[model samples]
Target chain A: MTALASLTNHQVRLAQRLVGAPTRDNWSFTTEPVQEPAEGGVLVKTLALSLDPAMRGWMNEGKSYIPPVGIGEVMRAGGIGRVVASKNPAFAVGDTVSGGLGVQEYLLIPQDQINRNGLFRIDLRAGSLTQWLNVLGMPGMTGYFGLMDVGQPKPGETVVISGAAGAVGQTVGQIARIKGCRVVGIAGGQAKCDWVVKELGFDACIDYKAGDVKAGLKEHCPKGVDVYFDNVGGEILDAVLARLARGARIIICGAISQYNNTTPVQGPKNYLSLLVNRARMEGIVVFDYADRYPVAVAEMAGYLKDGRMKSREDVVAGGVAAFPEALAKLFTGENFGKLVLQVASE
Target chain B: MTALASLTNHQVRLAQRLVGAPTRDNWSFTTEPVQEPAEGGVLVKTLALSLDPAMRGWMNEGKSYIPPVGIGEVMRAGGIGRVVASKNPAFAVGDTVSGGLGVQEYLLIPQDQINRNGLFRIDLRAGSLTQWLNVLGMPGMTGYFGLMDVGQPKPGETVVISGAAGAVGQTVGQIARIKGCRVVGIAGGQAKCDWVVKELGFDACIDYKAGDVKAGLKEHCPKGVDVYFDNVGGEILDAVLARLARGARIIICGAISQYNNTTPVQGPKNYLSLLVNRARMEGIVVFDYADRYPVAVAEMAGYLKDGRMKSREDVVAGGVAAFPEALAKLFTGENFGKLVLQVASE
Candidate 1:
């Protein structure tokens, strides 16, 4: 503990703003000696980090829901960590914490940045560290609020989700199913599709890579989709838009499919279907619903305990060095579940 | 009056479903002898018909908000008419009415079809015949509900409207202004642009033909657009989307620009702006608001009488014979304001 300042902390920093998809060369790996926390501050050692599709948007230099990750800065990420040292009475050493820990081996959060970083202790008894980074992390909050608030699924209504095997998609599907809504998933592969249905308890899963999405939607959602949770926006959005029941709700969560395009995103040409059906398309950011996260966390944690819900994380090991490849897997659909970078062993 | 049954009712019927924009060959001129009213029915003489962008959608072969106009059927339309004779106690011979009058000189509403056609007495003392076809008709109902309900503009917020001088656009801008929002309009030509700003009291009007709409919106709406009434879709819709304020509301009314496209409609490429700004995009079909039309009509009628609202109709003469040309003017952006087919003089 006396030699904490001598511990070298490794990090992956943005080398430049991304043009299309981020590559290895887009980031630079560096290391800096750790520093002791000043008065009323905390030092956290990263254990695991959640790699999300939204990170692709953060690499782009533009106005967005949040500020862009600037060049020469450590890439922003949400993760589970342990307090290595604490100078504040509110937190103590060895407490398991969750926060915007960045793609780094360690994070030094000043007293003023405590609230800004959204640092909080995680109850490991409820879920493991990987589970915390999966269904109990930022993605969980996003899917919870986006579906429960924006999607507003009523029991017996049909809810279709794109990227249904991914982080937010998994949570959205399980929650909708729990709410007694018919859950249909759209995933890139048959394995993913099968998993969402056979494992996650989705009513049906459409293998978008192997089959026609429009035809599958028509087959599964005979009455038309009442709530569509769109993660991969583009053709799938149009497909769902064309099959919406009157007064359907579409939750715009993320668009991994369009995030890496060099050209502009292909907007849903069938958007006028919203008019024909008198429907709505709304955007949801998890950060906005931060205040009510405890209520959601408590409810989902119960689901995890009772076996009514499950979570999977495609944990890629190699610490901070694996982040570049880990983030890239999101766009290629290579990662089978929540892509989490395992920064260190628990 | 006894010769009413002998009078020839000049009509325009759909020759075939249109491939893109309707042309002269797409319609056929026909005539039929006017029939006497059956029991519980009324006969109406068409005074003026509203030519709208939604008509283009009605001509296509598919399911829409309303069923497609069948081949060889009279082109469906809404018009201001006068009852020439009536057997129903609900209507008198001299009553002015508004309903789906079709592209014909006279319509004989049978006993069961009166409610289906939406025939209702129109108060001419509130607005003239052309005004009834423009601001007091379907377009007015569309603009009123779309702007007020879907837009939900707050006081001092910025509202950007496309097709500024058109029937729906004019009504939307005036109402947004009346609601104390800063109004900006996107129009086609200089004349229309000048009229929206100088006459209709919009803060600024963008001439899409002469200038860049994105830049114009940036200049006029320094605080960003809070409410957008999209009449002309395509590029103009994208422009307003690019300048959305946080929590903005977009009302999807009509896409006049894409209605006649031989190619697929170009979707708004900047639609992700909805996500970045935490805004919403909702579509409103005026038919959905029919139960509340009387409330909207009464409010807008008061605005017209008090001079807080104004209307302009570019009435094309030669009755139903000029239907094809008048309808074409909408796609070509030739009409100055509301394009109305003047079937006869009241």
Candidate 2:
């Protein structure tokens, strides 16, 4: 394929509305010849696309941090790309960049949408292309702010993380450990639990699928859970709620476990423990901390540089056609870390 | 009565564990005379008592912010009284103050249990005896901080209070209105609705039993609800959840509706709207703002004195015998404002 094909050609559009969980039938891939960029617009060739649990929330028809990806519209995704062509004064051909460029080999987006207050730019050496969408990106920022700002970990405090082996949960436990907290991670299996305690330096790890979570928490958090960073909100969150100490804080970064739920989401049965313990539980979106991204990025990158922080990416290589299956991996817990789609070759 | 008689006074004990909603038979009141006070104890004559919804949660055998009142123990109630006699240097005979002396007419309590921090002297001019148990007491403090600190209302923003015209709800709406918010109230009937809107100056009031709350909200708050100070939980709270503006906040001060629920408390079905609209629903206990009590009391009192803030107390006269019936008023929405029991005559 010519560079022009990579720049302004292949695309995927929402073929139909999803009935329940998304499937391959919901998307349709197509190809078009290169098109010239209009003034104030730049053409981007997507290289890597981030697959987040939030993608499920985005596909459904409802309100969220943003509106759903419309039927017959290019399926929306965040990606790293190269500016293969440009008519915007701020950008030129061949500048590496990132933005919500859709599931397409090429995109011509307006400068303002592309800029978004300078959140996206070309930075090849800042981190790996996949890393930019992982630890140095949304999941990293989610962990840093959700823990440091919302959870407010203090040294010697017990920090518990549900979905402990997943991308955001893994980073949350590590950050809690770095903050001098005694981190306890709750994942779904022995392997995930072992990785959390052995590789992530968590003081304890509970395999929630194998054992009774409430009992596990009782044995592990003898002092009680002071800060609970929750990613999977279901029975595990309920278990954590029961273990909260007086004045504990629960930071809800995401609730992946119940995302594809057909009916209304069910909350922890023991939430009133907040009143009984004089504790606080807050739901957070990472965009709320946008102004503090530079601070988080610098701190997280330092840990990565020093080998104190590690990130794993399950990269699926294909064109835009791989989006649906890769997104499903998050809910199944099949993606051990950040999931990304390699959309095009440089 | 002799000191020995007062010290061994008959105490109301939990007769049996409540299976679901508590009944009068669940409590048994027995009387005995007091014994002599310890070296640093005071003999108190319980003059006024505060019945709080939290007392219901405390009655259940479970862990909470404070411990359960315990089986066969005096039921926990905050009372204002005179130190009829004292052996403690910090208190003198006839000193008027408030203490957690349980639901008894007289008691010999160690000074540390009541006066560990310092004696909280009541200002007779603040209103009257029962007002201390209402407007200038726990419920008052709860309303003040939950709105200002937790709800964080902004001028002209819509503030909707559930259980409006109840103790905490009435104060929250009034305070939010005073803070320049366009206030809306949710209550059980037209009378309460009229009282809140016409007398209390709330922009509008919805009687949950009389109308569709969601439709009423859409009609009243064109801009959407910015602060929902929830005292009543369940469906009313769920209705409010659907109409939240972006960045709206739900301050969970109390859930009186769910306190007696036999099944586990069901979370608001629409809570996912918090993530969608970038809003937050948080649980807050008023005691967390203890350090700011003087600040709240001073402002509320000034409002009370200047005819800006209204303190409506629904007082039922009698001694400890009135406690059970008075507590029921909160659940029935029978009492218009703060529910207080007169434990003794002046």
Candidate 3:
């Protein structure tokens, strides 16, 4: 073990429950003396943390896939880290790992907490630390199973994805293209849309911020949408619902647009089109596919190596305190791709 | 035909388009000389007409599964009629047939129109004319296929349905019960709810008009809803959405609640529950299952014969002129079972 240093652990705690879009006041910066790992325990120093739209949902007080982060608790997050010290046989000093380390500088996971918190080793030679938090991480696994298992895209079918420049959407578009499908993406602005089409290789990208998404779909998807991977649900969902072809499959991955609304989320008014078109819309959560992660990761890793799949991580330079403001960038469409906050160098 | 009876054909025609619900003024009554069957044609006298909630959708001028009923044309209707004369080999005199006969005293269907109009012979020995328009007709077919094919209810699961007392709902409730599932229903009034539970053998029925459907679902479906067959969409659909169990299936059969709405239809605000529950919501139109109608009809008919399924028809006593007023009964919930108009007695 390295010599003991005079270091204090910093964490961003939830100060108040959010009513709408989160502000700086919602977080409380706190510091405490770093504690040594007890017997059968591991101490991990977070290198990079993932900021996701689902984090907004975790702030609300309600029943969800996972429990809400309680007041005065460290905010929950998924990140890449390196084990600084370990008293457990499963991990050794300097081993790169990934887990829900929260928005904190150090995580001291006891033996009893390891199973529940999930700590797994990763080979840094295969991908960078940021890549594990992005493509080989939760969002990539989400896009993989959601598009394949739920959307069930086939060759020559037209697949349209909302939130096209976001983490899951970019991965979904590229995967659909690799499977030989016509892909269209709906993103916020021209720059994001251009990046999706030019770099991500999506066949067409609709700039939803510019004008009517319905018209853009009409122009781009002349045959109508066959598979729709919905990440941002709202009017865009309704617009896509209106243009669905017969037997279309809709995969509900997330709903970023409805996350910040103080009012109730708007449902798709044109949902009746599902009846007219004999279509189906189903919801998916990545955690449900945990058992098959190995298969997905192996397939996606092969694609990454061949340059068939590209991952862009918008890594912001900051520690734990920047979490709240960095999270807000997702809602504003400021982040170009997978949003990540660098807590420390690898 | 048989001395060419001295009769003037009485008909109800569309006077104007409906803004909300159809009223008396939306129809125009007229009489004309009944024409004889031309070459390769059939002449039939309308006996009883099926008054359905779908009539409201047909009155609107827009794209749908079928073309809208045009102004100055006889209002479209489905009915069982006796063939008075025929120049086509497919039909014979005195043969009882079912098809889109429209609201009229007489129908002069040309041979070229026979295939498009879908005129088929019905065996009176199997069921009554009212039963042909009720249990053995479109609504029965709608319920059978919608619940079995779309809902795919498994044994030991809990199933919930809206429009419990109406044509489709009643059949759906009974079929789900026969499938060995715990069935719950939602109806407009206390009487309808009581009848659904008592006569239809549903486990419970929620009176949506009396109180909150959400509370009723929470109380009745403690294990949560596994299959929800939605007939009356709107708030009821949203309420059912909230109580869905993991892997729930929501079958969109009809939206009778939103049929008369001049404003936009209220979408299910809690549709995100589909995500949390990993559920699916799909739409079904009965016409799409036309090829398999005989299989569904035979099974449903057997259930009816064995006293496992019951048929109820709320037949109004009047001729073609009563069409407008009889149609409004569906929207107002005045018709307890299958609403039908008696043009002439069988």
Instruction: List, in the given order, the native-contact fraction of each candidate.
Output: 0.77, 0.42, 0.82
Prediction 1 global C-alpha lDDT: 0.91
Candidate 1, DockQ score (0 to 1): 0.84
> What's the lDDT for all of these models?
0.91, 0.80, 0.91
Q: Tell how far residue B196 is off in model 1, in angstroms.
A: 1.5
Candidate 1 chain B least-lDDT 10 residues: B129-138
Q: What is the lDDT for B251 in model 2? A: 85
Model 1 in CAPRI terms: which quality?
high
Which candidate, 1 or 3, would have the higher lDDT against the true structure?
A: 1
Order of quality (lDDT): 1, 3, 2
Q: Which is the leading candidate under lDDT?
A: 1
lDDT of 2 by residue, B1-346 (tens): 3635535465666777776667788888988776666888888878877777888888888666667877888898887888777888877887787768788888777756655523466777865666677667788889888888878999989999988888888889889989999999998899889998888888899998887989999988898899998887788888888888988888887788898887889777676666666676667777678778777888888888888778677777877776777778877778887777877775
DockQ of each: 0.84, 0.49, 0.82
lDDT of 1 at B335: 92
Restricted to chain B, the TM-score per model reads 0.98, 0.94, 0.97
List ranges where model 1 is wrong by over 4 Å.
none
For model 3, the superposed segments whose C-alpha errors exceed 4 Å read A2-6
Q: How high is the DockQ of candidate 2?
A: 0.49
List the candidate numbers ranked by TM-score, top first.
Answer: 1, 3, 2
